[model samples]
Target: MNKNFTLFNVLPLVIGWIGIKYGINWLTIIATTVIVSRSIMSLILSAKLHSSLSHLSETVRSRYRAVLRNPQLTFSVAIINMISLALWGQEESLIILAIATGAYFSVRHQLLRKT
Candidate 1:
């Protein structure tokens, strides 16, 4: 499979892990800097491409609404999160949750691709 990386994809994990190694303050500072940089780059690209900010925002808004509108998906995710939260103190629960969550996403992705 091909791995696609973007600012939103890779930066947070790398920076957050590094920050954890250093300190909470370092994490906040690095995360804020990265977010600000990404935002500025987005603005610059949008200006160069003559894309309307409202159009971009509308696309994101619609996607959020689409996800919220899917009752099955919304309830499934809520149940998953609730299970994880309920078993918050148990390592086994987390392991099981991760496996189940990963499988759910993988199956969904495959089904979507075929459709």
Candidate 2:
């Protein structure tokens, strides 16, 4: 079997197993996984960048940190998830959307304050 093909199949297989075992919706599981993974990757990349730029001024470093922590991707994913859930008649979508939006604004506010 091709390695790429095997890797692709593994995700769905694991997702399916998790959904079945936990009795959770597949879409919810996928969205949660993507969101968490994105966050972790962002944090790791930001930390690496911060360390590499240790000689930079605090203002510059802080701004870069804020930019890296921006929640645009997370907000986009949450919006899509909200729409999907709403279309499926799930009431929890509103709460998820609200949280994502709130986080985005909160971070933006802090960034603006720093600037």
* Highest-scoring model, TM-score: 2
Residue-level lDDT tens digits of model 1 in 1-115: 1243335435544564566566665664564455434435544543433333234455554553454343474235435443533433224334444444444444334333331
User: Residue-wise lDDT of candidate 2 within 24-109, one digit each (tens)?
Assistant: 77655574455444444445554554355536677876765566475565456456545544544455535644554555455445
Q: For model 1, how many clashes?
A: 0
Q: Lowest summed-lDDT stretch of 10 residues in model 1?
A: 84-93
| Per-structure clash totals for the candidates | 0, 0
Alpha-carbon shift of residue 66 in model 1 (angstroms): 21
lDDT of 1: 0.44
RMSD of 1: 13.1
RMSD (CA, Å), each prediction? 13.1, 8.9
